[model samples]
Target: MDTILDALQEGRLFELLDNDKTDALQFLAHIIEAFPEVPAGTDVVGHVMKREEAMNTALGKGWACPHARVPFDEDLKCVIGWSPEGIDYGAPDGKPVVLVVMYLVPENQRNHYLREISFLARALENYPGLDKLRKVEDLDDIRNYLLDLIDVSKEPSGPDTRARMIRLQARTAPETLVFQDLSNLIVEPVTLVAGQNTEPVVLTQNHALFEWLDSVKDLIGRIETEGVYQNGGWRVVRRGAVNYQGSRIVYDCVAFKLIQNRPEKYK
Candidate 1:
């Protein structure tokens, strides 16, 4: 439940643009690949598609869970894609699948992942608002139903965060939404994910990007504040603001990828 709730809270949930099962899974895999936890060359889509060919993952009642497993040990991550129109997933129940939850499983969290899926199955079967989920038009509503199924404990979220989530739910599918305005970068938190001699990918948030940004913090070795940037041989490649509901969450995005043969610290 935490993994699923974590995905929802971080804006990992999307209104799926593709209704075909392969396209939908591929779309979710594309998002997963960008995650810093995923090794640079992991073929998430290929792995998931191969698994799907072995068995249909649809849980009926318009829900499907597609996942890829890897050998690395890292935090479990997932992204949820909602298709109100439902995808023609080959479910045993003969129902079109509308909710596709894709998980990235690693060696360390295998047992934990199984338990979570078990709970999810139980909760969804008895969830009172299952029917409502099928008909909802707003992504926010879809998120709410999924959270409710998990019965997540309430946490006090800021207004900006709430507004951003609402905005993300309302938008047409874009690979990502980033605003560039450096004024706020002086005060906001930004992160960078990259490799040696490779172009870095900028990821950031200020409480409005659904909390997913936190997962990458582990991949960062350390950030030493110097003037406006976190230094230690790292430099800002991008400065941008995520604007939502009149609030701007700015970031000074630095970058990294698992450094080779470093200290046992990373191990």
Candidate 2:
């Protein structure tokens, strides 16, 4: 089975300028023409739309994965499109779609197709990664970003695993704050919360706040708060280090919690 990176690299990535879902699919079909494995009479758009008729493929956070299993004997193929202005993809979150990843797989590759889709859904759930994807203008950069994510995903899961987070303070600051996992990508404006009068503000999962605490930083101990209603909302707390200008800054970061008002699932 071809990995996600293999499918991505073997496929095409381009911008879909000001087009709806149907038009976007058509454009992808045209792009797929360059692939020699796809039969000359294959109806790429038709296959995708037929799948959509059964169910919309929009997986929220401004992403959609529309796929179809073709009657071919080739490996899985992908076509990734980015729409900076967003498109109406019928997402459950009511958010316009910014990224569309289309897949054309062989009929016998059902397991591989499902695994790829599931992995993408989990990866897209990371707000920080989604935020970075929105600002990606270069196609190569987008490819590299996805590749880096695959590497990060391979890192062993443990108590010390660190999820990516954005340092809200540097959003508007002149100096650029960079994280190793994520490069110099600017934090999306939506991730920042307007503070009342303090430099320290309560961070949320939407803000990409909590993850594993860095032990190399200052000697402050980590604290885990159980189901607290403080910080203007109900959230679990875990202290972690955020990399800022030449130092590791520690903060009482808020972690994700199961709440009644949680955002709807992206189907």
lDDT score for residue 38 of model 2: 71
The TM-scores of all predictions, comma-separated, are 0.59, 0.54
lDDT of 2 by residue, 146-240 (tens): 66565455523321122121112223335422211122111111111222232333333343322222111211321212211122222232222
Estimate, for each residue in 170-232, the C-alpha lDDT of model 1 and write its tens digit: 464453422111111122235554444443344554343214334435332332221122233
Worst 10 residues of 2 by lDDT: 183-192
Q: In candidate 1, which residue ranges exceed 4 Å CA deviation?
A: 152-267
> Cα RMSD (Å) between model 2 and the true structure?
21.6
